[model samples]
Target: MMELGPKPRRRTPTVWVGPVPIGSDHPVVVQSMTNTDTADAEATAAQVIELARAGSEVVRITVNREEAAAAVPRIVERVRAAGYATPLVGDFHYNGHVLLTRYPECARALDKYRINPGNVGARQKDRNFAQIIEVALKYEKPVRIGVNWGSLDQDLLTELMDANARRPDPRSAREVLLEAMVESALRSARFAEELGMPHDRIILSAKVSEVQDLIAVYRTLAARCDYPLHLGLTEAGMGMKGIVASTAGLAVLLQEGIGDTIRISLTPTPGGDRAEEVRVAQQILQSLGLRTFLPQVSSCPGCGRTTSTFFQEMARDVQAYIQRRLPEWRRRYPGVETLKVAVMGCVVNGPGESRHADIGISLPGTFEEPTAPVFIDGEKYTTLRGDDIVPRFLQILEDYVARRFGRDGDGKRAAAPAGREAAAPTRRGEEDAGGVAAGSAARSEAGRPGRPAAGTPAGSAGGRAAGT
Candidate 1:
């Protein structure tokens, strides 16, 4: 198979947020900010734990006021006592310098401090920025020089605007803003290094709401510095629009190998799930083949043949089941997140696709017999009908998990399961008893003994199978 997707990651200076490493050959990190009021230490700490459980490597909480800053140490203590070692980041804007100075405990408690250079004010911009850096240097903590387009440094923006006007054809306001964003981040990083902070202790981010603008700013920053870049599309609106926009922006940069750590800034609706942001980030990374956090449910978009919503309902249930059981499963089955389960509908491409999954089920469609075939390791294992289809398939799935990953009598996990190629047995030109067949071409391409042929279904060639 040919190499695809992201180019090799650009080299960047490594920075550690607690024990987790960012940049320079390490896996891309997923992070998120808590929406809870930081002044309420207990609530903030609880949400932090929740985000950590949802796979956020680092959790950020706003430290905008003295009360919030004062609560930091308590929040940190609670999270640590609860057995989560995930790093907590302090997101500071206008008053960070003062809060970090007056509340030394807050400075000590946080693993990292994020300073937005844009809102640090024009008259005391340098002084305020320097104060924040001094505290970070004193604590020996990593600092992210975050520059937001909305709260950009007015002084730098004004200067860039002036310079643009001198050109024969003046640049647009957007171009000037982009330049200012990059300039603000680089200048802040350089200043921190000058103040005796090591380059590796610094991370950088320049966020803009527009997808194209966000990409442009990060690409410029990546070219100019080796600092680890934090990727985000700030102020992306709520619901599907936010998810799509954030994914589009982050995916483009990630594929080009530009980001180190990422957070999806989605505006949650009233009483919405905060952990949804973390899931979105995980899905984006997993979809791009960058990381795996949970077992994936591959389901198909129902067409005319699938008249009933049985497959759709089954897909949702399977996904929910995986999510609910994932935490326990992780402790019990070390690599279960890599398991792929397909729940395909109809006979058109169902069996061919089902054979590619580790475990899969193909349910009957309209005008067809009401039976479902379950395949394990690319071979037809059993068939089911009536009300037991879901339960039977789930049982087989659980059994497969236990057999493949359950611990031995000695309390240690069993040997790692074989790869798909080894598990898939070659049938030559024979069809299974269920009227389902695995193509000879698929078997041959899988490096088994068979002849090559064309017209294989989408998920049949030893790849991710279609589900639902």
Candidate 2:
């Protein structure tokens, strides 16, 4: 037999915002909002630059009125002057068409514009969408249609309510809500198509406060359209609950290749910088191996065996330590994300879970032979005992990061590591995945080896893991 070459490799991005790609084949990009008064150019530009430094690749500003639109010129000029080249998004609610028309410079300055279809106009939302499309065409910008559950068009809600009266199911309210969002997006996108707007010029967000609702609506929308989807669970509470719920919801979607971009909207702590939400977005993505604005630290969930308050305190203390010393680490190493630092409570699956990690400390527990081993690059380098383990673990992490991102003056981004080559898999192998075809590509990212999630699992690869 003749020798055959490796299977042809191809990768597809999970989401596209106009020409901007996100998720999967593309690097995860972070976005944040400007807290400045929209009309104040200097203040808004400063905030935008600050947010970009915090890892916000895209910055959205509220354009509630024409004054905000008028401020765009100065905002654009100031942002450029600061040398922070983050893309700006205009948020339009009631009269997007007016600002988009009268403020060509502002629209042009904005890399993308956001429109809330429910609040765009009183009637014939399509006409309003058309008006906005003209501005996008004139400026050659992309648009994101953001639809919130609380702000669904009253007419659609009423109609959906009438349908729910006959269906009589627990999921009726949510089904109707999802129907409205998908319908709204599809309708608006149809208008954009009619006016000859390229599909790349459109992105859509269907955000609800509840995670389940957000997932359901977005799931339905993704199945139906090829447009880039922006994922968010809007107003998702504060503190731990917000983090848990948002992560849970997005984790489910991202595993299935449903999300293009994600935002974890968190309520800012009192007297704290609102940029925390943006940081959360970067952290979650980094943890999942989705994005790389920060270092990845893996700490095992504490259990009975070898459990210690010391481990708990250390995990948190180490996190803070990394953040404080990150600038120095960046000075030393150029691409810190390629280095992984693991802190495990015990052995169990700790080593396996973090096997690919660059460095890890497997605490003395059931899995570790006395004089617990500390692993670097998949092999044990030393046996750590006594009270020296924690500090040593932290030190190893710092050295690893320093070796990667660099220790240059004032801490700047160094060159990224050599690219990892990925080839798309051949076929789906889901055990209980429905509607999967013979040659459909399987999602090989998760550890399950093509198992669908619980509850809902269908993906573009044509099958789903059930239950999130």
Candidate 3:
């Protein structure tokens, strides 16, 4: 596994959510919760399917009341019948113990149960928590011991605060809260283990609204225990602020290899797509090189040198095209998600960026040539000009996909091209000499005197001479 930062992964016991693995050596799982009313089985089921289609490995729905709990089996049935085996999780709070007990079917239907350690009860904390664990044991399902900073166990928090007060140097309230959050999760997991739940059957989460607190608590928890940690920043507010904060927090921990599974708790805009949360999670993983869900297109931001919006327009169109074709590609070409395409605005960095991609195009800008060069595997193949640029470039992209990922007789995709060495310009030049532009300079030797190679520092080479 790739280590993104200094800290090594906190190796933990593995847990399975249906056929999907969580914990040691597994791909970090992406999960999201449905915002629909859980008691409305149809709405919940539809949202679950939409989330699954959008790449959520696990889908959670709130099961607060008896009505919601009762609807679990039907929701599961509807989702499963629609052809997705995505594991459905129940998010239970204060009334979880009672609902799981009174509605045995609900307990049996869910693949996993998420219990909040804080809201169970103050006086009967142990009893209520244990009751939920027992139901998990009875149903043979794994449990996620989720402890939020906002609803932290008051008893535990008070005890920690009192102990701090007696110290010569009391810790900050945020520090105390962090400690309490970690303690609540570890203690709850231990409680479940004591009640006959195996270590591998327990997952833990300690979420806080503050990004720093969320990262600190999880770091502490990862050091203390080997349970699979579910990472998230709780109650992240609406819009870009929420996306940025959640991404920053999750990225910190994830880069440190601290989380096993993750959820982005974004408050969606009114009537907006719920699938946006799932897409954000996928994007984070992809950007980190941890996972790939679709083909990646590297496009440059337009600038002063690029007088026309053609390159930016082409980039957006290409991205949309890839997204639309991804589903069919996945079914037909198993490894196509790894494909890299670049659409660069101006000649400066365009060719170098194009050279690095599986397929690329360098569009002309300003007073330069009107031609656009198409690149395949680090070599310039052809120059496109005028109204044919978009459609022809698209055609080249389609042919490249076919040549690289066409299916065999058994209907499985052919093996991917070996490596960068396999895509050496010499081989491609020999294969398609007619298409190769005569005297086209290779990427390594293309740099002009006193100028860095195109795309070397990324968008920096934008306004330079074409093919330099």
Score candidate 1 by lDDT.
Answer: 0.78
lDDT of 3 at 16: 65
Which residue pairs collide in model 3, if any? 348-461, 349-461, 446-468
Error of 3 at 398 (Å): 0.7
The candidate, 1 or 2, that scores higher on TM-score is 1
**TM-score of each prediction:** 0.86, 0.73, 0.86
lDDT per residue, candidate 2, 1-468, as tens digits?
Answer: 763432221223333332234444444456678766899888898787666556565678988888899999899787676554456789898898988898888878887889888888888677887899888887777788888877877887787778778774644566777888888888777778789887767777888888788778877888788777788887877888888888888877766667666777877677667667777876676666554555667787777776556656766766766666554444344555345667777767666654566776666664446554667777665666666565665655554555444544333222222222222211332211112111111222333333333212123233121100
RMSD of 2: 13.1
Cα deviation of 133, candidate 1, in Å: 1.1
Residue runs of model 3 more than 4 Å from their true location after superposition: 1-8, 409-468
Candidate order by decreasing lDDT: 1, 3, 2
- Badly placed stretches (over 4 Å) of model 2 are 1-25, 159-173, 300-317, 344-357, 362-374, 382-468
Q: Which number leads on lDDT? A: 1
Candidate 3 residue-wise lDDT, 1-468, digit = tens: 873433566799768665455785666777889989999999999988778767677788999998999999999888777666667889988889999999999999898999999999668889999999999989889999999888999999999999999999999988998899889998888889989998889999988898988888888998899899999888888889989998999898888888988888889889998888878887887787766667899998878879799998999888877665655555556567789999998889999999999889999988888998888888888887778677667767765776677675342322322211211111221211111111111122134443335323111233211111
Which candidate, 2 or 3, would have the higher lDDT against the true structure?
A: 3
